[model samples]
Each structure stands twice: as C-alpha cells, then as structure tokens.
Target chain A: MPIIVNLDVMLARRKTASKDLAAAIGITAQNLSILKTGRARAIRFSTLAAICRELNCQPGDLLEYVSGPEPEAAEGGE
Target chain B: MDKIQRLSSRLRVLFLAGMVSVPVLHAVGWAFFERIMATPPLNFSSIFGLSWGEPPFMAGPATLAMKLLGFCSSMLPGAAAMYGFACLAGLFGRFGKGEMFSAATVRLLRRLGWAVLVAQGMQVLHGSLASLILTMGNPPGRHVVTIGLDSATLAETVTGVVIILASWVMDEARKLKEEQELVI
Candidate 1:
C-alpha cells in the first residue's frame, strides 16, 4: 500500500521552501522533511490546516491514497 | 552516559556503601570500645558535647539543659533537610531521564537540581558550625576526643557542595541547550 503525501507539490505551488513551511507551521525543518517524505507517523488536523492555509491548497492536494493488494489476496487461506 | 546519569550512578554507589558502612562502624565501635574491653564506659556527653548539666543564673533549677536541648532540636531540621534532599537525589538517580529525556523529564531534573543546591547549602552550614564547636572549642591536645569531627565534617561539606553544584550546573546547561535547539 502507498499513502502519498503531496507536500512537495504544495510547496512548489506556493513557491515556499520547506524550511519556510516548517517555520510557518511551528515545527522543525527536519520534521517538515519527514512529513514531506511521507514518513511521519500521523498528521494532526491542526498541522494539516496550518499547512493548507500556508500553501493555499486543499487537504486532498496534499495527501492521496493509492490502491493496494485486495483483502482476499492478503488473507491467502481465506 | 551523560554527566547527570554518571553522577547519579556514582551517588547511588556511595549511598549504598554509606548505608552499609555506618551501621558496621557503629557496631564495631560498640564491640571493641564499649563491650569487649570495657574501658571505663564511654561517656555519651563527651562524644557529642551535649551536656545535660544544670544552669547557673536566676538561681533557677535547670535552664542550661533546656538550652542544650533546644540547640539540638534546632540542628535536627538541618539534618532532616539534608536527608530529604538526599532522598530526592536517590529517587532521581534511580528513575531520572538523562539528556535524551522528554520536556517533562527535563523539568523534573531542573527541580531536582534546585533541591540539590538548597540541601548542599544547609549541610555545609550545619557541618561547619558543628566541626568548629567540636574541634576548636575542645581542649588543645585531646587527640582521641577530636578524632572524627574534623575529618567527617570536611569530607561531607566539601563533597556535598561539589556534587550539588556539579549536578545542578550540568542539568541547567543541558536544559538551556535543549531550549536553544527548540529556538533554532
């Protein structure tokens, strides 16, 4: 399964550096990098809202869900 | 390990040794000096300078003893304060988070640092006064009588001050560094 973070697109659309985005969101640059790389454990709604407001994008523009193996295929024996 | 963690480990070892050694020393003294040879029975007042004597002045019955008792009672708080702070040291030493601890743990280390500083000051004052009274106030050449006070007081006061300051400064520096990291 691939859960995508389109943070790089959002950043490019707003012409903002990741460092500036991190400063705006009150998080470390390293943490912003983590989010941008889709390695964050989870995102807070407030953080997502801050990012959207700062980058002028909808939530869907920043995040996406991709298809994965079907449940039946995962279960094997079932 | 970080400095605080190292110091804490050292202190735990010292406290453990102290807990064992104190009772053993007392028991050994009792066996050798008091019970075994029985050399004229040790005078408790001579050892501690705590006289239960009668008072002069106002032709009263016994006021000096009261003053002595009050003095001893007053000293107890200093000792108690040291013990309380020592308990904090032990508690933190056992369970404290080091430099990698969370913000809450860092706050706890800060408070423990303050406690260490306060306790060191009190113990220094207490030990200095007590040693001065026991050593200089006693007769000039009483070697056996003044044997323990000077050594014990100097050792405790100096070590207490050093450990207290060392632990506090290390923790404070770490906290400031962490705060600065947050800023950057």
Candidate 2:
C-alpha cells in the first residue's frame, strides 16, 4: 500500500490520453484505470515494460514509494 | 462451468420438487394411513413386523393410545426430515444461480448442517421412544431399551460437520474475493 502508482503524472507530462495509452500498451482502459488509481494488486513486469515503452518514461517515473509511519517497538525489544 | 451451471439448474428443480413433495406426502399419508391400513382384528404382529414372543399387550384404551403415540413419534421426525430437505433445496437454488461463494449460500449451508444434525438427533430420540413404548409391558428383567448409535447416525453426523466446515470455508473465500475486487 505504501508503493503508489504515479502513472497519471507521467501520462499528463507525455500529453497522452489513458485510452490511447491503453490501446498502445495492449490493455483495457479499465485495467489502465486501476493502475492509474493505484488499485492494482500487482503489475506484471511485461505490462510495466509496455507501459513505460508507451509513455516514454522509466518505471520509477510511473511508481513512487512513500514510507509509512514507524511501528511501535515490540514488548520484548531492547 | 456452463455444464456445471446446467447441471446445477437441473438439480435445483429436482431438489425443489422433493422439498414440495415431502410435506404433501406426509400430510396425505398421515391423513389416510390409519383408515386405509387399519383392518379388522388388527394383527399387531403383521402390522409392525415384530414377533413379540407372546401376544401383543393390546387393550382397548392402550392400543389406541399406542397407535396415536406411534404416529406422532414417527411423524415428528418425518417433519424434521422435510425441513432438512428444504434447506438443502434452498442451497441448491443458490448454486443454480452460480452464487457459489455468497452469504446466502453460506447461510443455507449452515442451516442445512443444523437441520441435518438436529433431525438425526430427533430420529435417535424417536427410536428410543419407540423401543421403550413397545417394551413397556415386558416382565421384570425382560425389558430392554436401545439408545445405540448405528451407521446411519454416524454418516449423518459426519455429513453435518462437513457441511458446516464447507460453509466456513466459503465464508473465508467470499471475504478474500471481496478484498481482491477492492484491489482493482
């Protein structure tokens, strides 16, 4: 959940519509929407590669890792 | 999957028919069985298929009471069987709709488990009561009461536990499926 999809930012920068990107990447617009909204459970490497190729961006540009709050120490921790 | 759906549809019809018929059959049979089956002289041996090793302990009032009690004892568990079957029929209907991992399916399966388990318990009670009544007038030390568990009861117990376990598994699967759907 901490790994966020930044697909929308790259799509906007490239001036490419989601429908066009979906067509180019050989995926449904709905599936692309899921990826764009960060609702996808996982992205296949092949699909990620295709999206990057279509968007003229690297994988890092389409994904962002945000650190969550630190967990409390365990009861027995030193 | 299509074939499974088709078969489930057919099974749904059969189960529904059975559900409808059980109560109707019991009603008709209960209503007419006494009149149609009770012949003169009323040979208890032929009627019950038991050799008592002596004459039946039938008197005027006792015989009537015995007959009525037997009818109720037999029919009580018969009604329970109908209820159990109805739950099974409802479960089949859900399956027919292809709602395999639904809350409704889980409810029906749980109901079926309870129905079967309770019905089997009632059947055992009925058997014990019948045995007791039939041996009521036996001489001292000659009477016997049987509250034994047999193969049928064992099978029903296993079936009820399996059905309940399956329902629990389905409930877990449904939750997982919902979470997976939310992922997208």
Clashing pairs in 1: none
lDDT of 1 by residue, B1-184 (tens): 5776777777766665654553344334323422322343453222222222111112222234433442453344334444545555555565434534444444444554554445444444433333333333234553122122344445555655666565566666665564443322
lDDT of candidate 2 over A1-78, digit per residue (tens): 677899999988999999999999888899889888877766778888998898888989988889985334431111
Top candidate (DockQ): 2
For each candidate, what is the lDDT? 0.52, 0.67
Model 1: per-residue Cα lDDT at residue A37 = 77
Error of 2 at B174 (Å): 4.5
TM of each candidate vs. truth:
0.33, 0.66
- The local lDDT score (0 to 100) that residue B155 gets in candidate 2 is 93
lDDT of 2 at B72: 67
Best candidate per lDDT, number?
A: 2
lDDT of 2 at B179: 51
